[model samples]
Target: MQAVFATTQISERAAAFLPVERTDGFEERRYLDQRQSEYLRMLAELDELLLRNAVQWYQQQGRNADQWLSAVAAARQESRVQSGQGSATRRKSSDVFSRARKLMGERGFPEDQYPPKLVGFTPQQFGLERVARKGLERLKWELERYEPFALSVYSGATREFRTVNAPVRLPVDPLSPGEVEETCILTGGDPFAAGERVRPGVLSAVAGGAVVQLPETVSGRRLALARWIAGADNPLTARSIVNRVWGWHFGRSIAANPNNFGSTGGRPLHPELLDWLAAEFVDSGWSVKSLHRLIMSSRAYRRSSRPADAADVARLDPELRCLSCFPARRLTAEELRDAMLSVSGELNLQVGGIPNRPELHAEVALQPRQVMGSFAAAWVPNPLPAQRHRRSLYALRLRGLPDPGLEVFNLPTPDFSCERRDSSTVTPQVFVQFNSQNSWSRSLAMASRVLRETATEDGAIQQCFRLAFGRSASATELRQCLQHWRDLEAVQREAVFRTPVPPPEVVRDAVEENTGERFQFTEKLYGMDHFVPDLRAEDCDARTRALADVCLVLLNSNEFIYVH
Candidate 1:
């Protein structure tokens, strides 16, 4: 019979109690703290009693309860006598297991099946361990009548206010384990309680332009905010979205500033047109496609940038505020990059996938970038040409590590919302277009594409113009380009061009944290070993190289970069 019941349940539970295979270091107090000592003590008594009267206890079923109680009383008295205490007390948890060993020998069970000897396990820890195990049923029953656990209230923050007269502030105890709730003060620096709660209401310039009180619910804050944002009374959302789409096509938004609409922001240039668009936008069930269709089909939108008496119109309307003609503006950084790739016949139109790693300037890609003390891995362009030439929208943008080609062209950082891009022609833009490897590579590919599509040199020159400027070359322009190509071909046949030399790994110097000394480390450039580089000057014949030179000139031309 076991201590808790007239079965082997106590022995079985105790056998599975210790987390370890054996209580080897219990004598050194190592595992004794971790084991459930009370479980062991209970098993000790069960084993001792079973060895002496297993047959007698089962045969006398009527007297089993009385006999078990008597045995418990006897064990307690023996524990008290052994401890030299004046009153009866629970037996030492560690010694109880020792007492079980003597009895197990008489039971004829193998030594391996004996209870774990928790030598240094204290009775106090056993009390906690017991409450955590099966004996927890008893504690839970008592707790159900009252309360067991409750969340703690109150928190503290450092008195960092600089208005204090004293030179040094008093040292305050820091927050301990799991106590990190911070209370923001409303009227005073009270840390014990939370701030004064504000009435849940929405502030907006719609529906009489005042704060509207929200209906209260069990959980109302987020739900109230959602309703207010989507409410029919709020037309700000409709106007703002319409202005952004309008700005994307027109280069300048109706409101001038898409992000700001307050008194500080410029008033809409064409208020009536903006209002009509907004009204139609809301009426069409907020469909973006409907707005695009309406705007693109307008006569004003279809107007040519070069209207009749262009010089007279330029003098009459210097700002082009009359909206008599379409505006001619440079393509955006993204649009420019995509246009070049499209011209080269390498644009990949695949949508929605992993962020692409387009080829960057060598200085930027091979440099060691530090991230929280360790060096970041080398930047590797995608191995496949299709993946490498994905649309600029899918390219990965790292903060403070701008891709030189796009950055030079005034591509805004993704760190914050850019209501409008600032387009300025800088010296770097010229270098990126004329001197950068990416530009040269695109030109070479474009040349290859033109030659592959056209039958003769004259036809290839015409194809280049169509792809680059979206128009056929004039007769005079075609003749000049053909002469330039012929002359370059003669020079290129004598010119020496070398193949690209991509390094397998780049070695960089880094500072060692422990020694405070610089050391060199190697970073493997992923996919560089198997990189499929774009067409280069050395990849084709002298005629193709000369045509690539012509393509480079076209790519750098203002006509190719600007959209009319």
Candidate 2:
């Protein structure tokens, strides 16, 4: 998982495990979490083993659970001494030690449970020991080496926090990981055991500053937020979302990167028009359909993809900065698969429902995938046409099991939201398009479709062009295809083809992890035993075969793939 904080405040759930203070460095000096540290502590003493670097790697530099906890102790001790309570300092430390020890005790782990690599020392004692063993120069050098990672984690924490708190200010220990000592102090049943708890009001204060005001009522709140977001006064929300919709539909946004609108991002070619649309969206009460209508209705949208002036296109608008002509775009990963099925007269346009499992690679189908605490079952594609050919968006089984074919075309991973998809052409994409079973099947299906649409071979040829290219074949194109078909007639006569009826398998199954045993079961594949139209090689004649080749070229052409 690539960890990124869109802004700073980490989620409360994350904050619970890694408190805010641990992330924000302390004003005072602090130590490390040695017991969990890979270098110094004995793993046996810990109740649960954490990959030493896992949490540490996530944490901002100069901070750790141990350091934050130590600071909390120091602060508490200072408070105690200030109040003429010097006698309780050691007692407080001992109390913390006891709690730590008790938690370990409850686990009932043997003394040498883990690596049993070394004896133990608390984080502070270990740090001082390190100072002696490695000298100050070595310590400084090591810190420098790990500084970037620490800073990145810290920045990430801050970014996470900012998402919720929005410009929140919590005092930080630049050198410590985020930790909520107050949350931990409750372990003793003393609400104020950690001296003082962070005020809940801190969050409200931060949120109040950044969030736009909304109505108090539920529906009113949503409406008000919508108004604010779509309002002319707001520059980001409407522009961002609309740009995303356009990019999704057309393959590219007016602005190169849809989500990013910062100065660093590519400038919009039609800034005035974009602003006009944004204002119109607000005026229309943020209706998505309205924006779609505006864009799709424009002459700009319908222009031919071919650029008339290639030299001027390269020179005057080298980057295609000006909308000189519509650029043809390939169908998106989802659209490509869906469109192919549709063109083959085999589409099943069902709407939303539970996701179906489209077929996956045999290797990937059997590969083990992990969920929260256990492994998930291998993927099985939808057995029925209706489920399988549902709109690409409704296609099921999207738990990081991206179709390899789709991924080759830049399908986004579902684990996180993708604001915009990248469309870079690469060699692997060509390989997938040319060689994959899916491609071959789709190709043959085109041939069968052409033959079915027209009775005579010549008529079938014309139908193929009309269906595939959205226009009748030109005289020259038809002539060339006729010649190609004569050659292919002999090739098909010698070639053997089969439409494999895949064996049914238990699509969903259960497995016992503890015992390493597998239990299999099946679920209905939806509309089983129904008449299905598959790509059949036997269905096509010589002329239909020629048209299929022409259709294949059209589908593969750059003109059909890109959108202006």
Could you estimate the TM-score for every candidate? 0.65, 0.55
For each candidate in the order shown, give its overall lDDT on alpha carbons.
0.65, 0.52
Give the number of the best model, judged by TM-score: 1
lDDT of 2 by residue, 149-238 (tens): 222222222222323211233335432344322222243767455533222111223233665543322123334544554556666777
| Residues 1-564 of candidate 1: C-alpha lDDT, one tens digit per residue | 011111101000112223433322122221112222434455454444443443344344433334334444555566657767531112233233244454555557555444334322344333323223333222222222122222222222223354422122222343322232222444565545557544445544554666666543323445456676666667677777888888887788889889886457878888888888988988898889999999899987888888788788879876776667887778888989999899999999876545677888788888767542345456777776878898999887778578878888778887889998778999989988998888888988999999999899889999999999888999999999999999999999998977668887787665554345555644455466567888778778999889998999999998988867
lDDT of 2 at 401: 71
lDDT of 1 at 71: 40
Pairs of colliding residues, candidate 1: none
